[model samples]
Target: MPKAQETVLEINLKALKHNFEYLKSKLNTNTKFLAVVKAFAYGSDACEIAKYLQKLDVDYLAVAYVNEGVALRNAGITKPILVLHPQAVNFKLLIERCLEPSLYNAKILNEFIAVAQQEKQTSYPIHIKFNTGLNRLGFCEKDIDYITSKIAETSSIKISSIFSHLAASEDLNEKEFTLKQIESFKTISKNMIESLGYKPLLHICNTSGILNYPEAHLDMVRSGIGLYGFGNSEKENKNLKPVATLKSIISQIHHIEKGETVGYNRAFKSDGFLKTATLPIGHADGIGRQYGNGNGFVTINNKKALIIGNVCMDMIMVNITNIDCKEGDEVIIFGEKPSASIFAQTVNTISYEVITGVSQRIKRKLV
Candidate 1:
């Protein structure tokens, strides 16, 4: 546990370990694990999380872009870092740092091969991303032959692995779609292996994929939001612990008389005499302005406090009437109790959006 601060994001390492262990329990001993550290490890400090995951001996680390992989490399992370979306322009920097690029298209493939050959590289490892119904950045089934031909022409780069993304792994209602994706991935991978005469490691499962589609855990499994302590369902979630706790303190308490307006544009007005606590956190801290006017809330003194009035860029006023709190009382924006997922649903979103939306400017400390 960390001492309360005006505003802080506490990352519980113990919870992270628990989540990791639980997820690892779902995998076979032969399968490898990759931890997704993209989006600053979903806004919990990428470098720190990557370093810790590396210590856990994760087979791989993945990020959204080249800069993120570079950041991990600069932080002394030695695990193989995969940049999910690598532009041709950053091929030089990516190769220079030993960061792997997931070549999802022809331009990326051609451009990367050119750079690798120019650098006189031999057997440079690269991942091939195929489209398995995600309709995202990846080569389609029709392009498999062309991709194999291109790889055959290159000595500078070698196929490190092949992967695809699952579009609806979380929703049980979308089970058919997820299964179709797995089937397509299997067909494409089988063809690629026959063509190359050797099987490169194959992986397609994201966090939810690992939980819901255990049979599809090819050569490796990637854990993202799941690693952050969410399981995409009530039952799975019950066993995992939330790793990040967003906390703040009551900067002051104010007494409001009946009919008095509060905050900008009178978004909230007192109906009667009440006590409100001003918390030093707001939209800029990634809580967002829409999370106000009573739609969103915080917890104080183990009681709910509705967020009254429009959320400010740096502060929020909450109705604390009937709560036994005072100035400097600790407040929980979202954590193990209310959970980030529950809070995000109030805003018509998901846990990933809620956690990743947390502002990087806010301090993050590992416990």
Candidate 2:
């Protein structure tokens, strides 16, 4: 509706469906899929993706926080959503919306249980997160008993799933370590479930694990990046389709003589005659400052254009010297060619950050 102009993140729902089917194909018949829709569905539009996923009847959806879950609920998403890092402060809101929370530690488990008891909640679903070497969130191995005690004391909360974060499921060099993590998680989860005398969903695989270690996938798989196309391995990425494609129209083109500088700080000094095309996107739109001074490049008419100088808050200049381009020419930042993974590597990061880092300012159009 905003006119097929300026900067736009073209979202392919068909590709999303395809990726989901591909991942689903790799799992057991009874294995569930929890689509991670946090960070505005990886900065592509959570509301839209959630709606589409709900229509597809995905087993579940996951968000990083309680507020994100509430947003999806507000958007009329009724599918079960797991809040991966729910804080104690949001326990009430989480319970109010019938949203499930991941009880990672004693503090969270007890706090949520107390809230549930106060709200007269019974058999409420809650996930237990174990720290399987990620060292980020989740309860550590020593805290297992603490969680068990809390669950035994509280009859109000029901354990929904026991999950963990993998440290490096994507790296082939870390296969042994990855296996150790999987075994540790499996052993811990089994012990806890048996001790509790109840059955709960078991899941530990993220996008990478779903591809690299299907054996680690027990009952469910929480996929984020895989749903958006880019995989940890080139082989895994083959069947997947990239969901988010960034495109911008060149607003203006300028001829730069030798010695002329471009952009802020004169970071890029033009060498010989050059043509610079200005795109209507920048850091504010998720192209960080790191992608400057020829470090990151984009494609125009299938030709590579080196990003010239520092990326501004609202604009970026590309050296389109040999290309015949003019105002309104389409420029691809990351899509189809080069790929988001290539761009992420250029910034010394991963495609996950690249896609999730895209700011909300850019319009997201679902195709």
Candidate 3:
């Protein structure tokens, strides 16, 4: 790739393919793959990513809301899209778009049944979420009878899959907890399958779960961060390639003498003669204010330039006195060498937050 002349996020589909294949290698030959393309494909272009994944023959796609699923449908994505969280108000629109909803509770289940009945639909696909341990969403174990009774009352909707979310599949210390969650899900799925007299697809593993728990791969696996080139651990990260590279160019160079201040609120006072390079990216572009005051650094001409002072809305100044660089020179915020995970670790955050927090206003150059 050429040096960036302006602030741009380079989305490498080749890298995405590599990550996809790598993750697929870990699954059984018969296991299905569900690509989670929510939050704009983790702050990349969701439509483009979904299109590419469709070509790769992904078994299913998932989004967090009805509108997100609708966006994919508008983008010509015809794959089975699972709406991880759908509201009562959008049930009609969801059905119209052929998007499956994850009915987690009695209220949601009843509401969706009403909508499906009103729509005169038959056997519309729906996923049931069980609260094994996440405690965020899904039905309780005791609710299985209620859920089955409700299902028996209606043929308008059918259970397409039963799933759950693992709270900490990445941490080895949480092995016991994760195992319990998996076992609970197995029990729930068993009873539900027996009650329904048929088997719906069973899946509960996320990216970390896919990497850490191969035994729980069940019938399908959902991967979000892994598909975006992160495995949530040092060992697995080595096998994946980052899909997004944030790049920018030096807009201006400032020569600061002793006692000269830089940026808002005079955040930095130079103690000696030095140089600073201002790049056209800041909080507005997802660099965030927490990365300022020497906390964050960018790569310039193969050198590390520490971000000085506070991050402005649209620009950040990095000390480049020791680096051999000039205006219009390429700058790397985070990619390859210093991955997004490494960049985020400087401020005690995670790669998901940093990548997904990237502002949509920034140009995304697909490669």
Candidate 4:
């Protein structure tokens, strides 16, 4: 248990190792695994996660930006890190840290090549991102000619991997659309590599693709959420252990008379005499206000407790009338019976958002 002075995020390194091994077991021996530690390792702690993964002999570590890669480097992580969405401004830093930048456009690729040449680098590794269907990033298949031309001129930069993102790999209902995207990537990857006279690693699979579409794991697979547990299917999740277990202590408790209201705006009016537990976490801590008014719940002694009223910035009230507990008792926001998945479902959202949205203000205590 963390000291009462601060709220802490308990990171289960054992669970993380378990999840990693579980995901690795599902992959072919030839398929390289690039653990995506972007967004602070899904808002847990990227540097720490990356360091642990480095020791685990992961094929690669991936971050969303050049700075994220630099953070790992600063933290003594020497493993190769792929910058998934690097920008032109940080091209020098990316080169300096020996981080591979994902070149999505001719402009960025040219800029990076220039930087690599200026730095006297020989064959600096870089990734080409094809916009199969994500639309948010990457170059379209039609732009393959422009990409090939850039790679042809830049002898200092080498294409390390050609990758694309699956827009909806988890949704089996979109099987046709997903297949079309995969085919597009296949066509573009083949044409560009052949034209440039170079063979780079070909990969286009997220967590879902690795699990549901094994054929899509061309040379490498980039997994984020799947490595930390929750799979595309609930049935598949049984093998992946959750790496995070959020716990908070009850700061105070109140025995309210019938008709008494709880929290701001009197959002929760007591039906009868009730016992409420005040937890030390609130919206500021990533328990969003949307979770209030009974929409979200937590576990107290393995029993469900209803959240009442608007979630304050520093506090939230849970109905603990039936629970036999006192102040300083632990109330699990997630991890136990009422898992984060279930809590997110109540508020019409997914577990990813809820877990990643957990504010950095909470100290993460890796176990």
Per-prediction count of colliding residue pairs? 0, 0, 0, 0
Cα lDDT tens digits for candidate 4, 34-58: 9999989987899899889988999
What are the per-residue Cα lDDT tens digits for candidate 1 across 1-367?
5548679999998888888989999999999999999999998999999888888888999999999999999999999988899988999999999999999998889999999999999999999999988887899988889998998988898898999999999999999999999999999999999888778899999888989899999899999999898999989899899989999999999999999989999988789999999999888889888899999989997899999999999999999988998898899989998999998888898999999999988999888
Q: Give a tens-digit lDDT track for model 3, residues 1-367.
A: 7889899999999999999999999999999999999999998999999999999999999999999999999999999999999999999999999999999999999999999999999999999999988889999999999999999999898999999999999999999999999999999999999999999999999999999999999999999999999999999999999999999999999999999999999999999999999999999999999999999999998899999999999999999999998899999998787899999999999999999999999999998
The prediction achieving the highest lDDT against the true structure is: 3
Number of the top-ranking candidate, with TM-score as the measure: 3
Please list the residue runs of candidate 1 whose C-alpha ends up more than 4 Å from where it truly belongs after superposition: none
Q: Report the candidate with higher lDDT, 1 versus 4.
A: 1
* lDDT of every predicted structure (CA atoms): 0.91, 0.89, 0.96, 0.86
Q: Where does model 3 exceed 4 Å of error?
A: none
Question: Candidate 2 residues 1-367, lDDT tens each?
Answer: 2334779999989999999899899999999999999999987999999999999999999998999999999999999999988889999999999899988777677788889999999889999988888888888777777778877887798888999989999998999999999999988987887788987999999999998998888999999989989788888878789898898989999999999999888888877998999999999988999999888999988899988899999999998988987799788888657679988888699888888988888888888
Clashes of 3: 0
Q: Runs in model 4 with CA error above 4 Å?
A: 1-6
State the TM-score for model 1. Answer: 0.98
Q: What C-alpha lDDT does candidate 4 achieve relative to the native structure?
A: 0.86
The TM-score of predicted model 4 comes to: 0.96
How well does candidate 3 match the true structure in TM-score terms? 0.99
By lDDT, the candidates rank as 3, 1, 2, 4
Error of 4 at 45 (Å): 1.6
